[model samples]
Target chain A: MSVKIEASEGGRPHNEILGFGLIGSLVCIYLTYLNVLTGTEIFSFFGGLGAVIALAWGSDTIKHLCSYGLGTGVPSAGMIAFGSGVIAMLFATKFGIAAPVAALVIAALLGAVIGYVSDKVVSMNIPVMVISLIELAIVGALTMMGLAAMAGGSFMFADLVAGSTTVFGIEIASYGSSVIGGSVLAVIFILGSIAVQHPFNACLGPGEQQDRTLMLAAECGFLSMIGVAVISFAFIGFGSAVVALLVSIIGWAYTYMEYIKLSRRDAYDWLDAKPIHEPKGGA
Target chain B: MENLVLGIGITALAGALATVAGAAEDTESDIGSQGDPNSQVQLAPQMGYIHRIYNKAVSGEPPAYGLWCALGAGIAWALMSIQINAVLAIVLGSAIAVFVQGVYATTAYLGRTASLAKFEQPVYIDIIKSVTTVTMAHAFVAIFTTVAMCQLMIVALGHPFPLPLLALVWGIALGAAGSATGNPFYGKERQYQEQKFGAGVPISASGNIVRYAEAGQRSSLDNGWFASKLGGPASGICFGLIVFLELWRTVLFEQIGAGWGAIIAGVVLILVFMVIDRYIETWARKTYGPYVAETEEAAS
Candidate 1:
């Protein structure tokens, strides 16, 4: 008897796509409420959401998501919503209500510019970090100046300046702490990850095939860490330092555990399979 | 002492396993089959609970335990000696403790033979997956818990804790959280699926690149499964740690001279580690010989 399996050409079901949209919308609404309640404008949230959606809808961006199990339909939708939500909240807190929209615009433009420049640059990581750091510095300076101008010699301005400065001061201090904390934590994470991978590679040997796939997975793992850092910095300002350290550790741990679990499962499956006996017992 | 003994024991066990496995698989015909044989060691299908326990136990590896314990003790002393709130001291101390632990682990293992290279393909993948998960968990805990803890400390102590202390505490918390609750089941499902298909089965790829670029989807699908599972968590943890550390230090510690001191200390330590790692790698290469030389030596 012969069996046949049919392949489908269509994309993910409409319902799944719609489900992501619905989730995105709900998150948007909640974010909007939070911003308004905090006395921040709503435009920041909307603008952030718009930017995220645009990225999700773009072919290049969607391709990247698809590389990871995130389907274009639902996963993209969730990414749009989640990314926007987080970015919006971060901007609102850091730059105030009107700043999120501006930040989104700036970030998009910056991302494009950086993308172009990165193609020309030999070392992408350092340049990217530098660009991000510069952008952050500019935004911070501008925000402080703008707030000072708006508060123009009134008691309210005094309070605003005090509050803004206080926030900024707090942010600065936190960043310092994060650097201290993150340096150590990052080192540990790197060591742990290396340790795990080293023994694994040794056991697997050098000519086991699938080198390209493993390399890609490792690259993706590293990229994922960078992505987390980018998103966090774009949203939370200085607070992202601490977040970055935590995120790096988490990423490393998750990758390590998952790899172990999957390998073990494969081993079990192999054990259960019927062994074909060769006359010479050689492949 | 117990922790040190435990660390030594685990290291010995792992080292023994590696030597035995290596020796067994060293036969001439086993060259390309290393990947295949390594993939054949899965003893359990759904050992999620067992995996979790194993992860937890291993997380407190010697380096981590020693660093954290030392930092914790220091914080306790600082709290008692100064007019600092015990809570603030403890939290900050813990954060620093874990951060130190992480640094030690990274320094100790990088470019060293004490790594996962002895296991197999899936084991390597698991290490990455677990690290990502742990990093994310740590990030979340640091962000949420530190905020709450700092606020409480401020209230109880009638002022915010010192910036150095805060940084230390936050770092430890994030590290601990990452080590404890990060993903432990990253690549299991994909490995099972591949096993079910019985190695060498062609797999289809789906994504925007496939539709627009006319690229062969199969090529990209190799890392797809594992990468997909890991992307979010990895990104989350990375971003969280960077953002949190940057913000916390800038806001709370920059005014104080201690923050700069800490930064300098960190840089110096990293430099030292880098040198050590380089030396270790050089030693390994010189002692083991090149892959070709080793192979020839074994044959003779």
Candidate 2:
């Protein structure tokens, strides 16, 4: 099963797809925020979609940059993305409706600065390191905000730090836990990182195909959505949480199936396992 | 004025501590044969040269250190909240994190060596029994120093981020510093010394590394001995400069014009580094003169 591979084996150029994911996910996430202003949590799934799209793009960026022989840097890139992204995100939430846009800007600037440090002072010498890192940072910020929105129904500073204390017109003391204060933000950080980094790490080889890898990213993203949806129960309305959970589960199933199909298509042949024969005489 | 002075002092202390953390981190990673170079160590078995190196790359240096520092800071923060002495809390927290790091190293080494059994790669019990503790000791130092630095920034300099988050951020910076500045020394120089100096690693020599030491077969410890001198110190200085400059600007200019002064200083610093980096690149290209086949033929 020796198959020759060329550099053009992947589905699309990395940049074009990445640009689409970037702009599209940003728009969808902003739309989710706008929906929040309508006082309805029904459109919160758009936030999850935003996260998935950003992760898909981020995964592509990771694949592109880590190919420069980063060796173990695949995961490090993801961690740095979130590390900077979390700081930028927390800073951005201080703005009211402009939080998402603010987060994108801050995350971009932070990533660029870190990338500069990595290249100039540390002397990584990779040509695309700065741009890739910038993209990863934006992806980290958007994914974080999206998941936070999906979970808590709002990406506002007050809602994320100390959510409302009253429920059903009754004051519930000690129930003021928000996404950040309750440590849910930590889960989102790690979940987004793993989802963005894992697909490429697992699919990296001569036989790796972009379609399969992106599908796996989508699968991982949806799985992360399921996780955040469960956490949403702690903050959002029950109906919205259920809706998110259902949507996530459905999306995960579809993407997982597509990933499997792509894998099979790429494979030369399939072999079924059989039980091993015991030695002539039993041990 | 007093606040500025205190901030400067804290920044200086943090920068010094971060340097130690960076040095110790690179040394630990080299001893374990972690990061990009670890790929060669892994490939040694398949390439028909069984090695004694401890391959314990559970993850990249940045994320791994981030997890350790964050975990340590989290524990320390919790203990301090419960009225424990700060030093004791930090010690205990770092100790627990080191234990976790040791466990990860052990499992990683064991699992990796086990996978290479078919290639006659032996799992050196001595390496595991001894090297795991060595790496853990270094990790303990790195974690403790980083946590302490985070504490200094919070309590002394009035940094806004919480202890764990701040530790995570600095840990990432430390890891990136080590990976970028230090790893090349180990991966390019020490691990593949047989290659002509200044000639980059060729694609043909991907998995082939220098397998023999001066006396006998080399272990990761041998690499560590060489790396401790150049790689570790280089990484230390890189990280130290980053922390020192980053904090120096803020302390000096943060009070001016709604903190725009600090931002301007940061931009200026970046521009200076860009010029320096450009000069360094030119110098290297001139000195080395591209060690490719075409250049070699022309010279001949």
Candidate 3:
């Protein structure tokens, strides 16, 4: 019994890491295809994908199960999946629908088929890669076909055969882009994780570190507002500047306050302080 | 009603004066330590000017300041009801005001945090969530302030009132409610810290001087004081100033439209806040001595 328990525990990390990598790779491919073919901006598509990856990496299903036992993984998994779906939608909206839809269909079908085959096949990395590629292909294909159907064109297999050249071109570009973007992002993540783990790191010592991360992210978001301001001012006139500045200031203040409140609450928890008064119900 | 406005104006004036005095005292004391006592007095006015700017920039409760500023602008529009339709005037005013405050606050946060290194944890998720939440809240504040002021006007005239009075009422209500609601969030700590330190302990010598300096540094790079002050009075000041600018713009240029005015206000608010925050911090450091000195003095 002890030997069996030890084996099971030892096997889990390998399985989990493999699962993470597979899921991440598949998601990245699907998003990339959508961006390249659909005309989505690289930033929007990748931003959402990055968020989904972060959620998946941070979530520990086994830990949840051990702590709460049964039914615990659903909420966390649901949130990650929902966030991914939103990212996909946003990507589709920005890039145009053709590539995303095709990628979606191709990726899904491929993932399902490979996942099934992997049950019989004894290989590890190859199976994961096969599943990911299948899903990417299915997603791309289905997306394209669906759009074609909407345009009142034929949805024949022959049409897909003819369209495959354009589809393949999109696929290559997307794949190349994803690999570069994801690799760079992954390196950043790895470095950050290492710094956090190190004992003597001065920048982000362990106490309530999550709040700091959130703040940094919020700060990045302010860039979009500036972009909006510049665009509005250029198009509309100096009057636009007034509206832009007001909106930016108020929004910033509110978010800044919220960040402070969240950090304070976390710090208080770390210090074992009594609960502070919550906001009154009305406002 | 007149008394309240008078009271607010007086308080704002007093706060401004106190900030100036505090800076002067600090400059005088700081001169000896710098081995240049003569240069200190000349520097005092410059330092005092900076202190006022900082006070203005980094003062106020976040949501409340924005809310009040919008309300003030709304009231200003309602005051013009005789010339324009009441509803249109109120809408135009509140929209301009709220938009201005929002933009201002956003720029301030961006400018301050742009220099910091990225964090290890996942920042994007939390930031997106918080910003979305805050933006929605700000929008609501704008809507609510407009509605509340309109209601006050309806009751005051015993008939459908003119637009100008409605605008005035809206501005007054927003300012008053904001002050009342925001005071608890912004000044609560000041009150508590003051009480804890007692009247005898020089206000300047309070232990919070060290805490504030450290918080300033941390917040310069990271959002260290989120939970405690909820960005405190500094955020509030940004909100208020944005609203003030929105009102000023509307009064100055009627044809520019509310939307554009708001956007401009937002950007300026951020720029102004940063400038003031920089000086305020310098004053704090100069006045209080080095952070290490304060810590050592406290320990001994």
Candidate 4:
């Protein structure tokens, strides 16, 4: 039997990373609104970057929560975060320009309540459960909003739910269905869930390190950005979508290489495997 | 003023349905032996204690229910768009989702059991043929009730979210409630019955579950019957309260002070629960005390 030993006073505190992540991502995502308010899509990619930053923080929160021996709760926690985030986001976006701050506050309250229930009613008995869940809920909401902003060029409810499209040379009012009515929100939900959950699930073990896991988290975020960028063709112009796609690819490549380097540094040894041997005759 | 009364009515009806859905969801999972306890069940045969427990953990509770509820609600939404009767649409959609869940249950059980062939654990066709129907029945109740609740939110309460999205959100919440609140009762009290009550699972006893029944070998069917009594109800209350309180706060306080009232109510509710939780933890600790080593107890 192997015993899991957690450090009590080592590495960066989750709160510190959370502060940087929260402030940095909020600034980036809110700045992207300049494009929407100006009726331009130039700064849409900043929303994608904001999503990556928030997801990095979300990955750390997942790691901290699962470290408490949640058993099968790893996936549940991820789903719960997104589930609550979506509702809070839907509500917050109705406030027009205040969507970002509104989503942050709404998700925190929702997360706090859920965390309290998990600990008190369900008796999870973890000390940091409430705070960790609050961070996750907030991150989940922001990541979704960022991705939505990336895809639709705005986070406002009116823009997402009723934005028109230009077909051929004519501008089609409502375009039969808007970005959200066309089921882009569903796609965002699944993509955000996978991006937030896959990092720690892939890297967790006795040998797991925070930096490598966080790098992988960034890589996953960029990968999700690529998907969101591809889907943006349904909403934004081709030139803007292509720009987001290019930025996502560059970010993904950089982080992926950094993650690999960290993995090799922390690994005991690396071996290159040879091709499979053939048995002289083909089957 | 009329809207407030109508909202309260909708909230009450939705809360009741949520309770039923939550209970059925937990019971279905327990019957199938899904989630974390499933790891222990899988390890049983490898540890030289072969038994006939149904093992069908294809995924965790949240994602599974999310998929099921989303499909159900999506199909129903499509049918409703075509001017179909809402009740009939929900029933037909729920039926289709149950069929999908049945397929998953069968395949997961067969694949998991087949992999344990090296351990000499025989595949129980009888279980596959019988338990599949049982789980599907429970899943239908859960799916139908959840879909109905989403409909109520949309038609009665004027929730802005579309039907399928609402279903997805509540479905995930329901699965979380079941996984967190009800799973422990089935996993600890039923599977590891040999361990003393109120004492947590010891490290050494991992994967070593009680393999025998009172008269014959234990099976997941029996486990389900046991869990339905206590675990199912506990999960119901958990999810019910979550839905009730959330909707209740929004209905009463959302119009007050630019929605800060609802937010404040939520935070206040959380603080209250935190205090209650602190008391529960202390009481449980005082009652159970620390775990004593088995060897030391025997020696004494």
Name the candidate that leads on lDDT.
Answer: 4
TM accuracy, model 1: 0.29
Candidate 2 per-residue lDDT over residues A61-81, each given as its tens digit? 998888777645677777888
Model 2: per-residue Cα lDDT at residue A214:
81
Per-residue CA lDDT of model 3 for A202-257, tens digit only, reads 11212323334334333323322322232222112244344544554565466556
TM-scores of the candidates are: 0.29, 0.59, 0.24, 0.57
* Candidate 2, B1-300: lDDT as tens digits: 787778888889999998999999999888888777878877766666555677875577777777678767765764564346999989987887686567557545644554444455555666767688888988898899999988988888888776767887888788889888899889888877988776677777766677678886676778778878999999999998998899999999998899999999999999999999999999999987765675767998
lDDT of 1 by residue, A1-283 (tens): 1122111123444335334533442243234335335653322223223222222222122222222332213222222322332333334334444443444454445444544453356343332333332232222222222211111111011222231112423533222122122222222222222222222222122222122213223322332233223222212334433444354456546544554343443332222112211122211
For B185-284, candidate 1 gives per-residue lDDT tens digits of 2223332343333222222211101111124222112322333345324433443443344333344443458568546545665687689989999999
Q: Which portions of model 2 show Cα errors greater than 4 Å?
A: A1-179, A182-283, B292-299
lDDT of 3 at B180: 41
Residue-wise C-alpha lDDT for candidate 4, range A1-283, written one tens digit per residue: 1223461225688888899889988988898888957878978888899999999999889888887776456666777889888888889999888899999999999999998998788987788889888888998899999988998889898888875544565766662346578556775676677668756655544455677777877887887787677657656777888899899989988987786566555543332322111122211
Task: Tell me the number of clashing residue pairs for each predicted model.
Answer: 127, 0, 99, 0
Best model per DockQ: 1
Candidate 3 Cα outliers beyond 4 Å, as residue runs: A1-54, A58-283, B1-238, B254-300
Model 1, stretches more than 4 Å misplaced? A1-97, A118-283, B1-288, B291-300
Q: Residue B56: error of model 2 in Å?
A: 1.5
Instruction: For candidate 4, write residues B155-272 as lDDT tens digits.
Output: 8888888777888888889989999989998888788899877567777677778777887677677877887899999999899899989999999999999999999999999999
Best by TM-score: 2
Q: Least lDDT summed over 10 consecutive residues: which range in candidate 3 chain A? A: A1-10
